[model samples]
Target chain A: MSHHYIKTENLEYSYYGGAKAIDDISFLITHGEKVALVGANGAGKSTLLMLLNALKFAQKGTIDIGNTFVTEKTAKFIRQKVGFIFQNSDNQLFMPTVSDEIAFGPINMGLPKEEVERRTDMALQRVGCESLKNNITSHLSGGQKRSIAIASVLAMEPEILLMDEPSSNLDPFSRRLLINQIKSFTHTCVIATHDLEMVWELCPRSIAISNGKIVFDGLSKELFYNQELLNECHLEQPYLAKIEQMKEAEKIRSAN
Target chain B: MENLDRVISEIRGIETDAIDRGSRYRINPASRIIVCFLFLLSMLTFSVFNIIDTIPYAIIVILLTLLVNIPLSYIFRKTKYLLLFVFFIAAFNPLLDRRPAININGFIISYGWLSFFTIILRGYISVTAAMILILSSGFIPLCRGMEKLKIPKLLVTQLLFVYRYIIVLLEELAQIINSVKARGYGKNKFPVKLWSVFIAQLLIKTYSRAEMINYSMIARGYDGDIKTFSENKWQRSDTVFCIVSILIIGFLRFFRPFVFINNMF
Candidate 1:
């Protein structure tokens, strides 16, 4: 409903014993845009997502999500607009069954039983969980669990979808299906993934992180070709991009 | 193929499980508690002329245990373990009389020991009956059945918490074992002191992890109790199941049928 979906000004967060997780980062995300957060393990991607949810407090600087500054009251506003997807969907899908997990958020919000049921159905339908309504959540495959996890948050009807490592551990086919699901959503999305192809396919903009700092934030293609930047930060240049670069060099050599 | 479909439906579908047979014996958990008392009291108050009384009650309780689906051995094992606390209860039955010579066959020995054996038999039978009731109904449906009978939500919550968290703790313990195993500490590599040391480390790790999870759950707007969305309408089958169990228990309790020649003894 509001203009700016998310805005952070010089945001900094440190874990216990003064281990900085997000070091002086700032960004404004507009509504209806998709951004990929590209980073290695311990690169503070999940930390930043946690801050957006008001699950973790900012140690320094300001985060304003939907006109509300990130504070104790931030939960009221942030939770309505921001839906967080954990990397291990296993944790999110905690209920005995799929429909139960989908209904969990709505029920916790204390909606009418009828409305909760309706929301549960609608959310499951959105995630193509029609045949799985009665299936126990634990029995679901890795990718299926991830889909249901997203559906659970969707039941709450949050405006922004912030996911951590969305493509991790999914088979190639399931990964393709997940990308399709992401493209279907109109909500503003900040997805963190190790899959370079996924970032290219699903995210128009990409930001790279290293050692608790945003090392690169640019258009996806620009970040892809920045070989020196990638090498310095211990990121392998995406294979497709490297091949393309080699092809370009070959073409130039032949022309010369 | 037809038989296979039937088999699959029976095993796999929740719908099949939901079907209810009409049961006259579908007593509320509170009523069931009263039933348990009536069962024990009537059996105790009845005048027994010989082995007929004791033998019949034992057989009836065994049948009930079968219906309850609790293994007889499981009941025995639990009772055996519980003997520590009640070991003195037997002494009172015999110690009050000190030592009286009792005639057994032809010889007379210590009468106190006979009293003690009676006490042990009585305790064993009583615990087993209770165990059968618990094992037959299972914990959750029993809780639901109790809830339907207007048992307070607070009491039901206690049962739910125990049912849920015990399993979670067990699973977490398993994961801790796996992570330790993955770190080059299998049966062959285990050091002498590490057993106690690892357990201590696990305690600390589980405590901190629990604290973190508590924070995360709170952030998700989890107030004291989580709501379960699915409260299905009780099937006719559930009613029938309850009824069938009740009828069998009732027949075994009050009726003095000499179907077994062993009952004569």
Candidate 2:
């Protein structure tokens, strides 16, 4: 059996004026694998994430999401199978109430009313937001709003979860809570983030993106140790990684 | 504080009945439509014939208004907004007939002020009553009630569609204003020509958006039959609201003959 849940082969795409944004990027993630897409801004990290969810169709190559080939005809099916959490929590939390927002995708899928309610309850409880069932979207704090936003996609029970900058603009406590929530989920998740330290903590496998290309897809330990690679990507080694590097350099000095 | 407290203690619907939170009343939209039309007719009636006897009908109209859960304070406040228009109507009343101030006692009150007051008061009563019926019953239920009351399906459905579409249009309008604000138009009003041009642009966008929405609705299998799944079952509380409403309405309508002078009130 293949370990890959999402497999893309030479996925090429361009925007208006024939400007190539994402060019021939290929990646594979095993089932239940937590992957981090690390990149600076305009590096096509967001674009690739969108392609995986079929939000943006790849014209040149194939994006096989959960074993289904991505196409316009199969757009709805792909969308159902994959949940894409947008970078902006504002865009995701559109519905009036928390429960309704959570159940939006499922309802659009035309699930039975009872089934929708059951799924909503289950998903909300899973995210520890069952107490916020009746509250309106506008009244929620930024963290609570993000949690609810994630819960909305979770309610649909998507096999593959794509979250774009889940930790951005969040307080430390909220970020910790979010990390805890993500850790508990067994779903195959891909988080696009500028938080390199978070990537080190959460993702066992990291993909470094530079100029819309995957520069490195290696073990977490290797990604952390490679300072030159981080420099190339304009990413700094996190505090822990820096400390470890300092200790290693000292060890080399003592040995020499 | 004292006057407001007095007003609070004497709210029209405070003693009526508890509101049915589950919302299960057959609010006949057509009934409200018909009643509002009648209320409008009464405005014409008082204007055409300037008799103080018309005051009774106006008083009855106000009493009917009190039947709904509309607070008396709310009514007083809303009517105050109409006072500017009321001034124009009052101006016309005095000119029609300069009837001399007639009184048995030494109190000489002009018939013009009296007639104008009666006309305006009656107009207020009618308008307020009509508003209560419209607001309390709710636009949706009233439409449904009309449907249940054997209004033609086409008309009922058309009314519902228009009502539902209005929300979308209003949101679109708000969004356009917001975009305009984002581009530095929010803090200040525009020139007349510029405002008109913006409005025209908005109207075009709104029309196209509505058309797109209609297409989306059709794609989503909206075949025009809006089957409501909400449970609007009539309960004991609904019956109580109806009963108390009728009693209060009856009391106010017939209170003229009894003339019970309040001791404390």
All candidates: TM-score: 0.74, 0.63
lDDT of 2 by residue, A1-256 (tens): 4433999999888877866778888888989999998877888888888788766788798988767898978777777778877776755654445776676667777788898889889989988999998776656899999899888888778888898899999999999999999999888999999887788788999888888778999886688788788888887778877787889899999999
After superposition on all C-alphas, the RMSD of every candidate to the true structure, in Å, is 7.0, 8.8
For residue A130, give model 2's deviation from the true position in Å. 1.9
Instruction: For candidate 1, write residues B106-171 as lDDT tens digits.
Output: 776455666566455555667876665444433444566567667887898687656554444545
Deviation of model 1 at B219, angstroms = 5.4
lDDT of 1 by residue, A12-45 (tens): 9998896889999988888998998887788899
Worst 10 residues of 1 chain B by lDDT: B15-24
Superposed on the true chain A, the predicted chain A of model 2 yields a TM-score of 0.94
Q: Candidates' lDDT values, in order? A: 0.70, 0.69
Residue-by-residue lDDT tens digits, candidate 2, B133-176 = 65666555556667765789899889766764554555556666
Worst 10 residues of 2 chain A by lDDT: A88-97
